[model samples]
Target: MSGSSRVLIAEDDVRLAGMLEGLLRSEGFDVEVARDGQRALHLGLTAGFDAIVLDRGLPAVEGLDVLRRLRDSGITTPILVLSALGTAPDRVDGLNAGAEDYVAKPFDIDELVARVRALTRRASAVVPTVRFPGGRLDPESRTVTLDDDTTTALSERESALLELLARRPGQVFSRALLLEEVFAAADDPGVVDTYVHHLRRKFGRSLIETVRGVGYRMGSLS
Candidate 1:
């Protein structure tokens, strides 16, 4: 990684965790260790990281549960699962639970680090900084910066909604479309309106324009 990429290590094995942390740190990654699944889940939800190394047999909360919850909350951080369960079904279970990659326990440290580096590179390349009328949004950091240079952090859903509209400025998107794209399919379309209201309140009323009897589009921001 060219820049310092933050990584979270969620492994309960003391010796193994120490080794991973030491190696990752030596490789220039800023690493944080979480000894239990609860701590891992909390950090994953609240903090920002380029990638995460998660252990499936975590204590307090299983690693798979943590992964699912992170995805449910709209966290797009790349995750790699480390598990002793090396069966085909086990790998599928990890991937299905939202892990980007699965590594069987007793893995090669060099290979694991390489996989993490690849994940961070892929993530950085896919999400670029989005500039709109009055501000620019950094999707990677989930923050928006106004022309005045004031920056505000956004929740995962808020950032996703804003980025979607900002990317296709002035393109009308209906509530149903926004709901399906930004939220759970089971979520009511009204949730779109709710989030739009949130964006306007945080930014300004002119941040988004509502189309009468239709939907919403990017506003002039003036």
Candidate 2:
């Protein structure tokens, strides 16, 4: 809380990861993302994050296994599990694996941000910066300044979406996947298109490309 808190996101779903990364960046938290649990685990050990947003279902290594391994190694960094599994049993599984918190899929961005802040605030040190293409975002400030010095205040949703895209530039994402990451479980699937429209209007049509029958892609030109 005193400085920028770093958050590592471990999720396989491309669109969902982008959404979360974008939202958290706007909240002033430094964020790093991994496409699967194996890469996530490797970073979890080698990368110094204030906390982590881990997905229970992951590729390469199961999220639970990654958490368990981290705990076994005595890494006490707080972990918040983000999963589509909403049942009590599933939540319990994540918690038992040493996660600091469990967030069900179809989560509210505000709620997710609150949890990340709470967890990171407990850390005594600031999370380090992880840079990528597009621009460097200060996770602690929640402000984004483009390469050309253009800047904007991202709504929680916009930030999350952008973060995910920044994680892997030029990757296409589907509307349904975006919906799952940014909106709460109660949001209707149709709302994803609306959000995308808003994002295109703000970020420019060229920044995020429509994939026709599939979904959307960022950094289409680069």
Q: Tell me how far the alpha carbon of residue 177 in candidate 2 is from the true structure, in angstroms, after superposition.
A: 40
Stretches > 4 Å off in candidate 2? 125-222
Give the C-alpha lDDT of model 1: 0.86
Error of 1 at 9 (Å): 0.2
lDDT by residue for model 2 (93-125), tens: 899999989999899988889989898887655
Whole-model lDDT, model 2: 0.75
TM-score of each: 0.61, 0.55
The true-versus-predicted C-alpha distance at residue 31 of model 2, in Å, is 0.8
Question: What would the per-residue lDDT of candidate 1 be over residues 1-222, giving only the tens digit for each residue?
Answer: 556898999999999999999999999998999999999988886566889999999999999999998776556788999989989999999999989999998889889999999988877777857667777889889999988999999999999999777755636888888888788755578889889999999988889999998899877565
In candidate 1, position 158 carries an lDDT of 94
- Candidate with the greatest lDDT versus the true structure: 1
Please report, in order, the local distance difference test score of every candidate based on alpha carbons. 0.86, 0.75
Candidate 1 residue-wise lDDT at 42: 81
